[model samples]
Every structure is written in structure tokens, then in C-alpha cells.
Target: MPSLSPPPVDKPSDATTAQTTEAETKPHAQPDSDEPINSLDPQPIDESKPKSNLDLVNECDSFPYFQSTPQLYLNHVSTYYHLRVAAYPEITLGYVLPSVAEVLRGLEEWELDDDERTLTLKAGDDEPTRSAILARTTAAMREIGHFSILKGWRNELYPVYGPAPARDLLFSIERAASALFGIVTYGIHMTAYTKSESGELKIWTPRRSKTKSTYPGMLDNTVAGGMATGENPQICCVREASEEASLPEDLVREKAHSAGTVTYFHIRDSRAGGETRLLQPECQYIFDLEVPSDVEPKPSDDEVEEFYLMGVDELKEKLKAGEFKPNCAVVLLDFFIRHGVLNAQNEPDFIEIVSRLHRKLDFPTA
Candidate 1:
């Protein structure tokens, strides 16, 4: 198996600027800087033109990025077609771009429907058979060396469950190609925080390693990882807390509370290291870990550079500045809402923001 550790951190550049090194300020911002944004120094809010946090929500759930209607969104996806497995013909499984579909059509494993708009994988009803066919197909595509997304393949598998009411497993696909198929992927994101005696709250945020592939040098939640096949949400959270934050598994199991979920449909940008504009609908299982004041998060792997404990005020400023990864920002907003930091009294779009955070995805979810 390929080693999971990223390349060693690159030497810091002498001419790095805030605009270039700033984390997730833009969807595809470059990661040339490692300087952390000082959360203690708050920026002055322009009272003349107040900004809404709803913009952050919209950026993460970018299905409406173009400010278009549902029909328009579907129209924009004209170049891609729906994917289905022969075992369940009535339900759509995923999507395939024209180029990807062209390759599938030439392969014997896939059978294009009469409409020419849907491609179905021909396999037996068993889960192993379905998974074998998909594994073979994706492997062949990877060997062809034509698709850029496959170049960064993680060699990990993500389980694809059938639509609601049918919880049986359908198949599994490579983690890197999950977005290319436009399928609903699952992950766990935990927010580690501390509450002082005076009731003041602070959160632990980590700066991603500069050498990482996706969102390098960006800020992320205390602990986060994709849900591998056969792992529950809590198990994934516990494993990530140990691997990413160097926290003890027992402590994580004891402190981490299930805080519901944050769902969003994101379009991949250049920063995500794949075909730009690809669809990636995801459901992030959320957890909130309340650590004692004495506990601190440290970088356990090359995926993280450093951890910062910041107050709510500083977090707000960074949020407005777009310093956190898009989904990580969304998850933080959800934490703020649940903790009563954001409410109708202060945020005018409170209802809309809450509504958007739990978007009803069209695809199947666990």
C-alpha cells in the first residue's frame, strides 16, 4: 500500500503575502503562505454595510453558485448524464460526464440505456459482484492515465449505499473518483472547544500542511476524515481525533457528542485537485468535542502544520475573511447556531442559514 504521509513541508518563501497564503479566502486560493491569521486582533466591522454569514453557507452549498433555479442547475449539467446499476434500474446511482460516459460505453462492464442519457453497470444482484465490476472499471480508467483526478488516487474505498428504505450496500468506489461520479459521500467533522469558568468559549482550529493535495495550508476542524467502508460515524471521529489531533481515543469517545450533520452539494474548484467544476454532493456527520482547559491539540501527522485556539470574536473575523475551508466554515457556523452564538436576534437570515445547512440531497445517504 502507498504511504499516507504527505511530502515534507516546503521551505517558507521570503516574499509570501497574506493574499497568496491566506486559507480558503477564495475557493481556489493558492497555498504559498504558512502565517496564521491572528484571531486576537479583530477587524473593524463596516457598520455601513453589514455582511451576512449566509454568503459562507451559499459558497459551500454551491449548487446555487450561479444564482440559478433548479431547472437552470440541471441545464448547466447538460454535458453529464445520470448513472444507474442494473440491480436497481428505477433509482439513479450517480452521474457521468460525457467523456467518462464515452469510456464506459466502450467497456463491456457498462450497458448504455436506450435513451443514451443513462449508463448502467451490468452486474449480479450481490454486493460483491457490483463492487468487483466498479473496482475493475475504475482500475482500468486509472491505468489509462488520461484522467487527472485518478492521478491522486488515495487507494481508499468509500461505500455507496442504496437509496432510502433500502439500506443494503450497492457498491464501493475509489475515494478520489467519488466527486467525479457526483455521488453523495460521507465524512465526519468534529469541533473541539473549551468553555471557561466565565462562560467564554474558544475553539481549536488546525492549519493544514502546505504539502497536502487538497486545500493545502488551509484551516480545518479539530478532527476530520472521510468515512471508510464498514466504519460508523463515531468510530471515524475517534480514529481521526487520534490520527489528526493526537488525542487519546478514550478521551475522544468520552467527550465527543453527536451534533447531527451538515449536508452540502459542492462543485470542485482548482484547489480540490481534480477536474474543475465536477459535482461532489457530500454529507458531513458532525460532532462537538468539549475538551478540558488543560488539553491542547497538536499536529500528529504531516496533514497538519499547527493548531490555534481562538475566541469566538476572532473566529467570526476569520470567517468573514474566508480563512477556513468552505465546508469547515459551514460546520463552524452550525456549531455557532447550536451553541446559541448565532440567532434570529443578531442574524437576519437565521432561518435561511439553518435551512441551507440541512439541504435535502437528491442522492442516497447513510
Candidate 2:
């Protein structure tokens, strides 16, 4: 496991600035209103655009840097709350009102100022106790219908990553609202692919269950899960493979390979209360599992409705048609790049796409 200590933070250099400019030109979808609409629909590649791939990448990587603004705004109902950077006191991360902050403060170790409308989390607190407090708060909120909790499941703790990675435990999956206040979260995704005897590559995809609280009935990867606190990426992959796809342990242990990672900032619009949920600094540790052509995945968990094996061409067409989750599409793009399916020789925006796919994220760890 890598050390949790943060690397020294630095300002974005000229090269980064140039890359940002080149990458922002591609058209990416944003929510038109406060609805959880799918925004990862593949846009028609405009040959007239000099930097098309950059735009594609930027659409998925939407979170702005903490230093870029004095404060970040979060909307709830008709009100907007400002969240300021916890470290750089002058900069705002985003906003939340006192009442909202109070609901969060009901948990342990949260510091909020009504006057400044700022929030900070105390680090190095007792893990078990903090977890308990958060769990109780989550239960209370779920009772009042703030969000639905997975039945019989406890909230999983996730480490907080930032300029100064805190040893202090951060929010759990249930309290993901805390992430919008400028915390970074992590998830794991696995791409299971196999090749036919004729050498055609096919991918294993799953449709999310209609009962899912988010992205119900949307297309997802073969297996995906959040990286709970104290769980490593490999452990997460193995567990999700079993729970979501009913893959045997031995098959996953031998076939799963750490392919790389993709990070982005996204905001999910909520139609329930006309609010927007912020996904600040989310990183997906991607893995590729080359399963045998004969192996079939059976959906073992309620999270998935069904699984299918689709050829790469069909997958691409479905992706462009907005059939897949936005983030899942980005992961597929990374797979395409690594497999040589997308390259400069074939794709005009190869450089920009490649660069944006591997955008440099400021994770707390080195």
C-alpha cells in the first residue's frame, strides 16, 4: 500500500495551462437542469475542431481546482452555499448554509462557522467512534428520506484525499454529501474483456438494477464498487467481482490486472429537491480482466439487472447513443486507448484524448 502522506502541492505550470486550453474545446455534456440526466452521450466528432479529443476528456473531468476560485458554490433548493478551501483560507471550495452544515455537524469532529459559512474536518480522530457517529447520522437521515440506505448494509468509510492528506477518517458512502465540501473520494472499476476464436474483442457489460438509487437501469462495467476505507484496490476488485458478477475467486485472482486509473470531478443533479450533488475529486482505479471466451458472468447482486457480452464496435455505438454511464464510457475510452483501438493513426484527436484520459489529478498520496 502507498503511504497516505500528501505530496507537495504546486501551481499548474505553463504546459498544464496549454493542455487545459487544448482539452476544453471538445464538446461534453453537462446537466441541463437539476435532473440526474445522463451526460456521457458521445458527441459527433466534428472534423472542423482541431482539438476534439480534449473536449471529450474535459466533459468527464468537470471539477475546477480549489485555487481557481475564491469559493465554490453548492445549490440546495433556491439557496447557494459557498465552500472555501480548507487549507487556503482565502479560497472558497463551495458553499453550504448553516442548517445544512448543522445537519453535517451532528456527526463527530466537523467544524463549521455560521458567520463565514466555512466547514473543516478535524483530523486524527478515533476511527471506530467517528464511524459510529457517522453511521447513526446516516440512519437518521435515511429515516427522514434524505437518501435511501442499502438494506442491512453499514456505511463504508473512505479516506479523505487532498493537498494535505489527513489521517483523520472522512465521510462514508452514505454521507457522500460531505464530499461536495471539498473532499476527494475513490472508487474501483474492472473491465472484463475476452476475444473470440476469430480474434474479435468483446466486453462484458451490466445494466444497473432499476431499484438502484442512482443511475437505475443504466449500463455499467463488468464489476465496479467504491473503495471503502482500509480496503485496497485489489481487495475491492475481488469483492466486487464476486458480489456483482458471481466470478469465482480463483479466476479473478489470476486474471485481474491493474490497468491504470481515471480521475474526474462531476456534479449529479437531483430532481427530488432541485439540488445538485457534487462529486469532488473522484478517482477510479481501473483494472482489466481477460476472461476465457467460454466464461460467462451471472449477476449475483441486486445492483445489476443483467449482463451481456458485446463486441467492441457495438459497445462504441451504444456508448455514443448514451446507453452507458458517463464515467463508464470514460473507462471504456481508456481501454480503447490502451488496446490500440483509438490512436493517432485512426483518431484525429488522439493526443488530446490521451492527455485528457490521463489528466494529472492532485491526489493526497504521492
Candidate 3:
């Protein structure tokens, strides 16, 4: 009956924790040292990659980017509105707003929570970018009215089938990660370790390059992204560590090692099945980052085509033989049992992680 863990927390040297994970500046222009995107006959831009924000999305007849505001209703049966002095979505890459969401009316399937997709509306009541009304967002959503990907009931109400859509409309994950699934991604349970002398810490595992699109170059956490549409999650953790390592953006803003967060959901992807096929979207976030033992993780052979390091008893013996990615072995056994370097044991290699952290510290019994 001995299991407590919640103490060891020292890691702070890389310059008082660096901070500034992508403060929005180079969000659009960064793969242009020349823009041939690599060739000599290796073309794979496949084209079709524009899910939302083709100029802030408003569509047609003088869509300049919103300005109108004067429509209300409640006792008359609820139906107020705004955002139409010009309309937006001119495409900048489905994001880059300061005013635009609140495009209400049942939030068009909000990834599928269906309370008619729920939406009340706000975010540019007059005009000037704040955007956040994807239509009432739920109550049984069905296409929050119109943003047209080629309208006329956008393919028979699409996944208007209800109970999903708080955010899933991909359009390119091969067919769009399981039919647009409910889009709002961000995972990076990273590992590329270094630092050992009995002072221990060594991780680096990679082996997933099925010409990746997601899980293709799957080793686990080599910097991840998907928070677009007016982003801000420390700018998707410095735009996923400089788009998959080689470090230096002033050493990720000067060392600043260790930080954490994680959430989950996934689907077998169909990859843009005809534009965002009948979605299945349902996923959250995950961050966990901790660098500098002598920092040297520079892999982006076009998004991690695999690598390897080892230690922390070989990342707890390859996550107890399951070989990573169950949310990256629950984030490297929760950052090596929160930075003490994995201890608790009873043999059979840490007795099923102390019976899964004693069903996760549910302590109370006497």
C-alpha cells in the first residue's frame, strides 16, 4: 500500500524556461527559401489543400470581409445576425483572424455534438475580425446555414447526421483523417532524448514513414500541429518546434525546457474523401516538451522518418513492450514519472506500472 508520486520537480536551467512558443508573426511565409518546394522531378504537392479561410470565407457578390450589423430576434423565435458588410474567407490557410467566428445557426455539426450544432453568435458584430460563431454549434447541427463548399445541401446534409462537429472538417489526411472527423488537433508527446552519465536520460525512437500524412512517419511526438483558425496554444507550441526540429530559433527561444498537456481521440482516416467526407472528428490536445541536455534533435527528413536514442531504462523498456504510441506510451510514462526517472517497481517490469498508477491515484480508503 505504498504509492504516492507527486514530488520531484527541478528542471529549470535552460534560461528560466524560455517561453514564446510562436507569437504569431511568420505564420504564413516560411517554406520559401525559393519555393520550388523541392524538385528535379519529385512533385507531390498534390494540390487540393484549402479547407477554410480562402480570404476569411464569406462568399460572393462583393465579399470584402464583413461590416453589416442589424438583425435581432428572440421572442419572435430567436434569429439575430451580423458579419455581412463584405464577407471574409479569402484564404490565407484557414486561419489568421482577429474577427470572424460566430457564424452561427447550429454551428453546422460542430464535429458532431449535434444540439442542432449549437451557436449563438458574436466575433465581429459589425466588422473587424474576432470570429467565433460557427453557428449555434450544437442542438443537432446541420451545416450552420452556409459557407458553401459547393452548396445546395452540401451533399445531402453531409454528416448532418448529428452528435459531432465541435470541430472536424479536414479535407486532406489522405482523404481527410477519417472524414473530416471533428478537427482541432495538436499532439506532440515528444521524445528525442539525450543526457546520461548515471545522470541518465536517453530517448529517441522513430520508425513510421509510410510517406506520412499523420502517423506515417510515426515514431511519436516530433512536433505536431493543427490549431489553426485564429490559433494560440503558445502558437501551437512554437509551430511544432520549428516544423519538426533542427532546433535553434534561438534554441527554442533559449532552452526553456519542460512543459506539459495532453488530450485524445482518433480515427482510421479516409483522407479528404471528397472534400471532408462524412467526418468522425473527436480529438483534443497534448503538449509535453522538455529539452536541452545538450540539445541536438534535428530531424525533419520531411517530418521525422525515424531515429533512435534509448535510456530511462530504454523508455521503460519500450513502454513495457507495447512499443510506443498509446499516446506515446502515456507520454513517456508521464515524463518518466514526472522527472525522477521512473522508479516504482515490483518486478514484472514495474508491476504494470504499479497497476497503472494504482488506477491513477484514486487514494482514499482507510
Candidate 4:
């Protein structure tokens, strides 16, 4: 395990800034600051606009620097949060970034106001120290091959659809004229399946976490996790399943069944804490996983309590009762309707989509 402590929030002083050197804000330094606009980096900011000067303290707070320090894994949380540069197909060092342990000793430590929230780093003993920390952290991340500690701090933050990188890494953003930080969101659904006595297949439903970020204490499909910076949908599936249930990577990778791209562009879940900065927009990439009926499930206590197995009629009744999370309900119904598992008589929407797909494949309509 790497050190979880981040520096306390404070601006570097003349002794800190003057003594410390600034890193070159290379396009490759940040999580989403890559070569193309459509790439991982945030969209370009129009710098032709005017600037504002509102401050009494230091400027470092406006342009925070992290040592690409590995984020701390808080107690009881399954997800990992830490800063690193964005991961991409570029190269400065070969594969295998250095461990955070290598640079841990050199970091000047500080603590936030005793009762304040959000732990941050405060180390810039000198320009060389600052430069060395940033540069070395960048290089270490480059070697580790997990993520990068973004370079350019002065950029505009923009709204994006999914993960920052096609991988899972962390970065920091400070208030700047360029708007350094931004947010990404994700969603998941589990499609449990079993063979009927006659050899038909189906799915199972689980109860949601009463303590969940959204739709607390309701029933759900399986599990889901947002794609962090440098992550992908398939990766989200694997990660979410692992967090929610004891799903082996192989099963998630199997791709036995799929309900592609069920999304809600304006969905919001207020239960999500500050990790999402409370901007739990209605955004997610939904998927359905049909598992073998007899395959017992292992769920995470932090996320779920328990679940039940039900056939089409039972599931439909649950759906009508509005017992499941709205998004999960959408994905589940879509899954059954997609796999020919359901009769497609649920509503006009199901009938329409089913008929369209069946006819597209030249199959006789039921």
C-alpha cells in the first residue's frame, strides 16, 4: 500500500515559489490534455477573453500541484482515488512507472485546518524541490504506466461524457484562468441468467444499497461503477461487478450477453457524496450480464444487502410496482426484451424495438 496522506491546503510562499521551480505545462502532463480535442484532455479554452484579479492570499492554491501521489484508499471505500498524469498511447519513458514510495520521503508535509475537509499537499521547499517533485512524479507515473499527473494547469474545464482516459487514474484541478478540473460519470447493470428446465435462459435481481449514492434501499440488477479517468465501459463493467459482487474477471470478460448503451443524459443521484462533488448527473453506460442460474452470487456488504431470483412474470410485477431503481429498471427491461427472454408485450416501447430488431434480422414476428 502507498502512503495515503496528501499535503494540507496552503499556497507556497516566496521561499517556496522562488526557491521552487515550475514545471513546463506540457500537453501530456494533464489527464485530459492530449493531442486532439476529441481525445482524453479537456477541450481548448478561448484565452482571448479578459482576466480577473480576485485574491488576498497566495497563487499556488489557484494552481495546485500534486506529486502524482497515489490517492488514499479511505476506510470502507472500494474505489481508489489518487493523482497521476492521464494515461494514453504516448511515450516518454518505457512501460512500468516508478512507485510513489520512491519519492515519499522528499515530500514536505502539512495538514489542513483541523476540521476542514479535503486533504491536500503543501510541499515546495524550493524551486528545485517543486520542479523535481513535479517532474519526478510525472516521470514516475510515466514509468508506472497507470496514469499521469497532468501538465498544463491553466486550462478551461469542460463537461465530458465518460472517463478522462481510457484507463483509471487520478489528477488534480485548481481554479485557474484555463479551468483545470472537470468531472466524468458512469453506470452499470447486472444481468443474471439461468437455464430453465427446458433449457431456456433468464436473469436474477438484487436489492440495492439503502446507503447507495442513488436509489437507496431499492432492488437492482447486479452492480455498477463509474469509469474514472483513463477507463472504459468494459473496464467499468469489470470494476463495478468486482465492487458489488464476487464476479471473476473471466465471467465479466466472457461477453455471453449484452444490452448495449442504455443511457440517461440528465439523470442525477443525490446520494453520491462529495467524491462526485455532488454533480451526480443522469449519465452512465448501462450493460446487462446474464449469469448461469445456479451460480451463487457474492455481493459486497457496503453496496448491497441481498437479492432474489424471479422469472419474467415476477420481474414484470416488480417493474410495474416501481420497486427498482429507474435506470436499473430501464436496463433490465431492455435486456430481457433484447435477448428474446421476454414476450415483448411489456409496453408499446418494447413491442416497437423488438419488432424493429426482429424484422431487421428477417425473423418472424411473435
Predicted candidate 1 versus true structure: per-residue lDDT over 90-178, tens digit per residue: 56665555566666654566776524456777666788888887777777777776678988898889988786687778888888878
Candidate 4 residue lDDT tens string, 307-356: 66677777766665656655566566557656765553534455433332
Q: How close to the true structure is residue 338 of candidate 3, measured as C-alpha lDDT? A: 62
Candidates' TM-scores?
0.83, 0.69, 0.24, 0.44
Residue 79 error, candidate 4, Å: 34
Candidate 4's clash total is 38
Off by over 4 Å in 1: 1-51, 65-68, 113-116
Candidate 3 at residue 91, lDDT? 12
Ranked by lDDT, top first: 1, 2, 4, 3
Q: lDDT by residue for model 2 over 1-366, one digit each (tens)?
A: 111121232221111011121111211212124432223222323425332334445555654443442122111211323333234343333333333454554334456554433555443345454445445644554454433222324355666432334433433434344443434567789999998778889999999888776657778989988887778899899998999899988889888999988877655434111234444556799999999877889998688888999988788777656566667778888998999888889888787667666655433431
What total of clashing residue pairs does each candidate reach?
A: 0, 15, 96, 38
Global Cα RMSD, each model = 12.1, 10.5, 22.4, 17.9
| Global lDDT of each candidate | 0.74, 0.57, 0.32, 0.38
Where is model 1 poorest over a 10-residue stretch in terms of lDDT? 20-29
The parts of candidate 4 lying over 4 Å away from their true place are 1-184, 199-201, 255-258, 267-283, 341-346, 351-366
Best of the candidates, lDDT: 1
Candidate with better TM-score, 2 vs 4: 2
Candidates sorted on TM-score, descending: 1, 2, 4, 3
Give the range where candidate 3 is weakest over 10 consecutive residues by summed lDDT.
72-81
lDDT of candidate 3 over 218-325, digit per residue (tens):
356545545443444555556666766665555544443445453322222222112221212222244444465666566666656656666666555444444443
Q: What would you estimate as the lDDT of candidate 1? A: 0.74
